[model samples]
Target: MVTAPFNWRPHSRGRIADDGHGSAVGPQQAVDVEAARAARRRLVIDRSCRVPCLVLFCSAVVWLLAGTLLAMIASFKLHEPRFLADFAPLTFGRIRPAHLNVVAYGWAFNAALASLLWIKCRLAATPLRGGALVLAGAGLWNVGVLLGTLAILTGRGHSTAWLEFPVPAAAMLYGGFALVAIAAVLSLAARRVRRLYVSQWYLLGALLWFPWCFTVAFILLMPAPVGGVTESAIGGWYTRNLIGLWFSAVGVAIIYYLLPKLTGRPLYSHQLALLGFWALAVCYPWTGMRHLIAGPLPAWAITVSIAASVMLLIPLLAVTLNFHKTIRGRYRLVGPSPTLRFIVFAAVCYLLVGGQGVLLALRSVNEVFSLTHTIIGHAHLGMYGFFTMAMFGAMYYIIPRLTGREWASVGLIRIHFWCVGLGLALMVGVLTAGGIIQGLELNRAAAPLGHYIDEHGLSEGVGAFLSQLQVRGGAVDFLDVTRGTIPWLELRTLSGMMLLAGHIAFAVLVGLNVAGHSPPRPGPMLLSAAGRGRPLE
Candidate 1:
């Protein structure tokens, strides 16, 4: 078992009666010294990671903006298919997957890798190892994403959900990820702090879990293709694991680190954190197959998946309680600290989304929501509502330290938060409500169609079947179902625009901060007017 570092000490401000030099150090003086040493150590770590982290972050922002545009296009096309009908590359089919790949691999992965590097270095109390390798990896990874996105747009992309990237692009991503993984491992091995923080456990798990999932998915789907229902099962497994095991792991790690650091509170319980981590690791892999509920998969497989999804509540509650107790009386800090605000919001989303996921995994719920906009909304709630928000908070905290400058405008930060928050809420709400309507209509339509297929046998053509479906009383028409969702799709497009606005504001803020448009901050840049001049910790 790992042991705590000998030098680890609780934050204290007690006076020392005597020093080894035969002098007395007052309480305030001792506190200042300790703070200074901590600051210096953080500076060294940040400086060591500055170039690579900045590169990764900047690339992430670019991809974020690009993906946001793609999302807007795709969202608009859903309600108005003829909007970009003339352009083959701008079709909904291509744009949607391109947006997904760009956001997932381009924005999310880069930001996550940057966070991993900096957080690992700080947790280990060591300067980043293999910074050059990390930089090179960033280059390769971004290029791969760009190539993959282009391939998707140009119609050469695969139909796989997350692995839409071509083989060459996937290979590049794997190589680049391997290089950074090596750096992360090296940093961990060279850690000055022998005891690992809770964040370290999660970061390391994410770093390891992603590669295993990605490689296995790649091998099964690409080099030696699986057939029939097995392919769909594997795809579902990969998609679920990518979100639950990989992205959520990194998101949770950031939350665990940022909450206590920003709030100046010790974690409520170390035991809770451990319990949450292990519970998540053990349960999330099995939970992926729940996505295949009501599909061709076996009853036992779906049953096992649903059970594992329910088990996720263990970690979900553990994390929620740990965070809630840690910030029990420090709610005031959430107003003043951008990092705290975004992270706290994300922490809450984690609970909501986790619970929703369990509900979705149930066969009864899955039957209604399957293949509807509801699933799309849920995915966004997890990806953007939780993971992206956490990443935003992390970048807000890390960017200032790297650039020695604070965010340029508090107004823009507020705009970013509200736009994203309101937009996502609206989007998810409408899609869910609309999806239920659509699902009910489709389910109603299915009965007559199934009856016709049963009576007419396989010889009846689609034309005859559809003609018969039209005359059947009480049968909901497919066009009516499509029309019913149009308004919700329109609202979703509007929400996408709002989200795009927020992303643009964020991009501009990052630009100003990195370009040193704002005066150098004396300490962390808190969001509140009163706290602007105050130093954190």
Candidate 2:
């Protein structure tokens, strides 16, 4: 059956994902084919890993584009309410969060899962077992994502940031996962190799973390059972874990895989990798409290949380040192090979975000940083800069194996890398700068005035500046704005006529923040655009 399943390839481009004629290969050549199949199968797959990877890749790209479109709409809404005010469902409030969810859950995660499946198989040294079940699970998961995302678009979504899906959709997604878990367990147990490597540990940790995080968050925050602020606390807890337990786990897995692959040697410090893993798991749970610091939560909760957040430096330093140490003489590979380049980018981003997280946890820092775009900026650094970059590297590494061709063209890869990467870079810069100016103004208990406001407002003023900066080619200099916002608060007037920009920002932010109707007033929006509607803090 295993051998027969693979025969569907060769002449068909999409054959790996299908299964039909494979049941009829003659017995003689079949043995010869089987021998070679086993050889290639060592690379992983019963039917073929690439087939599922391709499908997943499509799903992810679509979601990302969808999310981007949503964001652009949201940006417009902020600046011109009447632009789409006629369509209540298309409001910035709705589309922004929806886009955020789609990208985070659908785009980034689906890509991660595609890569994770590849790594999981390689680490286990096993061909996939329940191909049917996995296909079903993945399909159902997509269905759930589509329905849930549409729900958000139609304004039927529950108001949870990372956990926005209503019960039925969430159940479908989780239910699909249960099948995959079953398949994974069966496949692992049946593996030809049993080295019990550390990468597998990270993958397993991620697998476990998803359900645990989702379940806990659901019980505490789902509409049918919204437990008030307690649920809110739990929901916050889920977001942190999604980073620590889910995305972080996959990130660690990528590091473990890519480090050895790029250097052409086993990991230089397996012991260090293991140490990082356990430390993260043990410490991550406590770190969520840092987000709630001075947020009407208990003092002990915030203090311990802050302590845990600060302690993350241990993993950050250890992982950074390990990655660089391994890459000491291989820096050239980063430029020559897209895979290595992305891996290097993601690793550095992880360190930057991790270190920044520790800093933000500080009482002085969080005091000024909380409830502003500064926090949002930090979140994106972790999400896009760290996690998304790793995911892209993973895709570059995995696609050829699945596509059975060298990506049709390196030009496409380069195009995507530049467009997507540059876009994100621009976004991080503008937001960071706007955040800093806003933070400073906010912390001072007042907004900035004439000259400074004109130079840095994110609405018509800042938006115009950014638009002009785009023409000037010196935009990245503004990234300091994003980072600086962490040290203070910022707010301004209330004319209520918010200036909107491109839709991309709105969708992404909304998806990121959809945890709970986003606090209605959002403790964090802005002074330049959205601020026109509400009084300043």
Candidate 3:
């Protein structure tokens, strides 16, 4: 009896020797021919999704540069408030929101859509339907992002954290997303294979969950505004679900799809994957109110959320163990394949971010860190370190297959990787350390004093001492405890610049590849001399 090759598609029926010559062929040769045909079929399906994916990717790069410029401006204002304080549009308030909107909606989600479309088509083993509408939807998404960012600068932004886009712009986003999402749904419906892969679970879940989350948040925060502190709770719910359910789900799905392929191993346990996905779907939506721990929100709501937040450790550990087992012996693949390197990096970051999120949900911890820069670091860790990096890995893997070309330069890839890695490390590190100190100072009371003089030689010992420990206490002079944060903020600014440079390099590389400057090579792109001829790990 011939043993079946691992991961063989059961629906693959058109093997090369099916034309009455199968009796003369060896079993191994027959398997090889079947594999080749399956690959060819996948290539055809992939090509059908290429144009729309490329359009979204190109538009995402443009928004990335725009967001980077805005990030730099906002970071500079943290340390040098007077740099552009005179201009309302350049103020930190407006610039910060615009930066968030562009990066979150424009760069992050657009790239994610591209990855999802390609992965869905390949897994479903069907040509992507409604390609033209997909492209049109992507164009509409860009238009919405553009208009929303401009509206934010012009002081039309809503007060909600993640749902800051105006109603009209929000409508555009919702409609466009519907069109793009329908394409993926239709492709899945038309799948040739009956057995669904693990990646499809996540891709399908996100497609269904995002519109509900987006619409509910928009209604509560905007047109049908909720009165009082309930609005705050709703906003928190929206932001957390957007990250955990939508962005995290898509990123995790890509990681799952890529890992098995790159390592040439099946996932360690189907049970663990099922556990992870179900736990995420059940637990994540309720965990959002952990952010509202001590706020005016109801006590039970906050308590339930904290419980759910801690429960997330189940899925986090499940995913961590699964990815770890898959990649344990195949570590050598990371050196040769940029895509594998990024995917592994993202997997590790996902573990770290999830753990940190649980820690932040504790009542005591939330009380201390809620008003500090620590939360800012956590956001960057999830968004850039996890989600953005996974998107990068997916693009690196898919773009070449679409364009029929290899990466332009391995050296550029290395630079881009190290630059982003070190910059994010610096950013999260400095902000976390500074935030702790800031939090400590704010919580501590003034020292006992007798006849201490103020900066102008005035004697009001208790008042002067209390003023120094205030949260925003730089009013007297630069000697206050809050002043210590300046150097750290400036370091963050420098790290932002490094990250900006890396983004520019990535965009240029993608542009060059799309313009057909890079030709296809026989094997994978390897970083080491000895690894070039080795089979893919």
Candidate 4:
């Protein structure tokens, strides 16, 4: 059985170390020496990662704030369009896509890259190599995201969902990612550890999968655009894979690593982890076509996607069980450790999102929910609730170690957590419930209107016929359907405000820590009142 390299335990206290003069050293002393060596090695690796990781993290935080502002603007405009209607750049169309691209590429990508670099180096037991190249990549990536976001606001964005960035911006992003990918490969090749962990497998898979998906989507959708339903199919495929294969893979990898490390426990089952990985690998790629269901796509394609999505339950169950068991006895640690709490929350979101995905993929459910606020709520639950939360947890754990400092304020952390958590839950709940009502209303209105039009015909003046149909109670107005959703949209705006406040608190905390306002402490910062100065055992 392979043991975790991070969790060190002395095999036998009976074993003694020999001193230079042939005097025997105590086993406890020998264990301490080994533990010290491990600590020193970890410190070296952390120091090697410090500069690039900090750069990536700082950039991510800036983008996060920008995205949050954009999100708030867009959310408010949904219910009160006149609030920002005067500015063309701040129109709902522009601000919505701008918010999506900025957060996904700017904030999430940068944070994920930083986590990948730091975690990969530690797991490999190697110092980072090609730091200059990584820094260059970070610079180019941020520049690309900046230009892309500006282009979106200025109405230069593409029609594609996730690939809204223009061709030039996409090219720059591709180039920037290539450099980071090269550095990752080199780090992997130079590893001191022979055995690969489950987290390493996930990181490596994500690193490969993202570039392939991005390149294919770019080539087909940008330079030589596909026509008609094929275009929608390709876009749907790319968006689904980008979320599942890239963002989700990285998030799950971080969870696997942090759950064990923070709790100082071995993973409950390596076999289970491997099972989840392989299952996800097989299931996720095929599941993308489900997004194109009821469209002009082939029936078999949609069926296959639905099946794959259902099959995803296997991996979700495996991972959920493993994580739950690993952290079973350590529930108290969660309250104290911001990292554990965020990660644990993220894990629960993962389960909820995955299960939700399976249900959404079903034909009956998809027909009603598609193109509604329900889908929006579901997307945010996966992206913001699961992936973003995981990234936050990772930053909380990694930043302190890299900077050799603790978080400046636990209160700020608490505020960040509760506010974001509650806001997201509220946003998702209202949107989802409201979306169901909206969908039902729209569906009900459509059926009656279509029936009226078929029977009564357009022989009469078209406008007069519609007014007559409404009077006859044979049809419902589209405007009324839209009006029904307004209450939910207003609630969504309130949630956005809550989220903004949380993000500000988080930004302040990160800034304080990075600015060296927080003096270095001896033990890990815990939130518990009684364990303020207690060291990890």
Candidate 5:
């Protein structure tokens, strides 16, 4: 006797029962019809944001290629300082910093922005209101990156590690970021959905935190300092928190969004997620002091930092358990979903990197290893292994939807994964070993510092030996200890080459997919068990 709503349509099987006068759709059929319409509306909202996202991604991939080349040059220059020493711009000192800045600002930040914008729109269930603003913001960001990179190469760098952009360039970058952040804020405010998802919390947190960290770091490191030791303390704080608050926040947001969707399950525990978020916010900001453990900061500051670093385990374990439970029986999805595979890999790296941070913060360990290449290995683990991999996974999932086509070649995807994975492992493993050798040798009281310079006479070998001994740490036989790092450095260079090739393949694949080379398909472009066949999801 009751009729379904006016917009209701019968699902398959013509299940609607007819009253004596007219056909009436069932209640379940009406619900299904509404759900289907909602999904289509969401798709439309996402498509509306596609153009700006594409511009950001395209620019990001170009920067990725450039950064990998610079990394290769810097890695090789470590062992062979004169390899390109003739060119001032390509020298190890200049090229190394340039590589770091380009990858972080140009590639990683831009990539994160693209992913953030798309995901935010999806979760808010709203179309982007200011598409032109997003595109213009991306354009200005690229301009700032270009100007900063050129300044660094031209020897006008700020001399800070990640904040090396000159003042003018930094101003430009800050302005660009403000515009992008505003777009995110407006989109979130105008959300049609009432409840905020976990991913939205992370996206908002990162967008807010990055500018705060950047501005604080700039004030502390750029202009005149309060004191020499205070400057160092602030710089260390900014550097450490930048990785945790900005990069890790964005990376984890992507994982949260993709994992549930990929596994066809909701998050395991909302309370656990809330716990993780609050714990990280309260604990991660102060943990930066751990980086200055052996430096001239107050003991209380160092102790607080170390404690915060160790306490991070609470959130780390909480998030790790939440994700594991969500993906409990869906391991097979890793094969069919590149997004799941990369997110899982990034999750594992998060555990490794966080545990490593706790270990490296202890005074007993810090005394010997603080100055060694171990620090370099750890930095890469967080930046490249964890954050970058998460972004790559997000891109794989997002691009196909935006382009309305599958990937160009499944084979290239496998190649890119293995290349980046194996290369990062090799580089990290080798550097860790070399750092241990250098640390143990440098702490040996049997050999004095003066003896190294007196015997070796400031030649290239002697310079390397003394440099390691003086800062990074060395042993009784300075030459022997310094020589131990050479093989590792060479291996690192080889790994960098692998990374370069992998990035090139990724760029080409992205370009092809965007250009509509791949035939349109309903399901995802996924590799099979053997990692060669195309298996639809």
Candidate 6:
């Protein structure tokens, strides 16, 4: 019998076969583990290498389409609130948070869990029980999202943005998550194969990371963790922590899985990966305070936050260096492997987003950039640019492996990648431009000082000051302002409109194209099929 290259135990082996041997031992008194391992591994390999992965793939596409629609509607709202103003339930405010939640929780997290669950079973030599339960759990989550989206649009939103889903919807979501998590854990516990792998680290982390973050977010935000003025800071920290711990873990885990798969290599330095993981865990909670820079929060709070944010460079660099080194010389394989392309895109964005995050923490820049589209722009860089991209890569790689077939069509993958990538890139461009312009306007201290602003001129002092200054500067004074040149909010809004249009087109194309393709037949051993769909010729 063949043994796996990686050292591991198979989760369980058949109990009956050895009876034929007729040894001194009774039929069940003792069984050979190695024999059992082989049998269990074969069973898992045979079944999992079927339709389950395909189901996961289709589900991801559906959720992503949902997310894009939300993003597109929200983008329009940013520029023209009237687009859906007549429909209170479909207003940009409601749809926007819904879109973020759908993408982050629905599309990304679901895809991550599905991929990890499948991969974990394969690696651990375990088998997923009740694939039906997996499906039911996924279905329930989507249903909850539908209800939550509707609730938010109808003004049931708590206005917590990411956490806007009402109590019932939240409870439903938690139930679904619980079902899936329990299945995954049980699958691991029952796995016929016993050795854990690199991917399992991510799978395990994801299962744990989300519950921790989500529980905290709900405890703090939904119930109001504290009744005082300090609640906002806790809420902000909770939000950032969710993104940092849960969403961020999902994105990086995909990178860890796909990058190595594409190259047909082991990770260059497992040691470096450990460093990155540990550092992120230690640093993220504190970095949350950076969002509160110069707010009513204490000085030390902000100081420690800034310090940790700066130190975030460690994990960021660690991942970058690890991936860059491991994938070296495998660039040729990328064209052949959709997995490579998707992960490569994600890794690049990770570097860019991490750098942008640190820069935002600087007080001078925050003074100008905090309240405007700049913040949104940076947030998306991490959310879409890095997180979404990574999730996409995982889906591409996982789909074929799970389904035991090639993608429905490579053309579809390419279209999805470019549309989502370019769409988000455009989003960043417009939002960033708008943010810079608005910040520059705010920091137009040449008019005066000690001024505070929100994303819009919302507050009374800020509003009155902004109005008074407009009269003083007239239109001509706008040209000669200082602070690093980012675009103004007006311009940013226009740019967002354009990006929004692109994302809409991308979403439509993805939906239409995916719908057009028929499914493929299953096969064995799920060869990495590592490439964009072309051979070496």
lDDT per model vs. reference: 0.83, 0.64, 0.81, 0.83, 0.79, 0.64
Cα TM-score per model: 0.90, 0.76, 0.89, 0.90, 0.87, 0.78
Q: What digit string (tens of lDDT, one per residue) describes model 6 on residues 154-230?
A: 88876665788888888788888887788788777775444344456656776887777677777776765555646
Cα displacement (Å) at residue 240, model 5: 1.5
TM-score of 5: 0.87
Q: With candidate 5 superimposed using the best TM-score fit, by how many Å does residue 512's alpha carbon deviate from the native?
A: 0.7
Best by lDDT: 4
Error of 6 at 42 (Å): 7.8
Tens digits of per-residue lDDT, candidate 1, 130-151, equal 9999988999999999999999
Better of 3 and 6 by TM-score: 3
lDDT over C-alpha atoms for residue 148 of model 1: 94
Please give the distance, in angstroms, between residue 162's alpha carbon in candidate 2 and its true position after superposition. Answer: 1.1
Clash count of each predicted structure: 0, 35, 0, 0, 3, 29
Q: List residue ranges in candidate 6 displaced over 4 A.
A: 1-3, 6-46, 49-57, 191-195, 445-537
* Candidate 5 worst ten-residue window by lDDT: 13-22
Better of 2 and 4 by TM-score: 4
Tens digits of lDDT, candidate 4, 1-537: 223232332542111111011111222445565556667777888899899899999999999999999998998888888996998999999999999999999999999999999888877778888888899999999999999999999999999899999998999899999988888888888887666777899999999999998999899989999777888888888999999999999999999888866765556777888899999999999987887878888899899999999999999999999888877887787888888889999999999999999999999889878888999999999999999999999999899988988999888999999999999999999999888767655653333233444676755433343454334233246776677689899999899889889999999988988999887956688777754443232
What TM-score does candidate 3 reach?
0.89
Task: Please list the residue runs of candidate 2 whose C-alpha ends up more than 4 Å from where it truly belongs after superposition.
Answer: 1-39, 43-46, 223-226, 445-537
RMSD of 6: 9.5
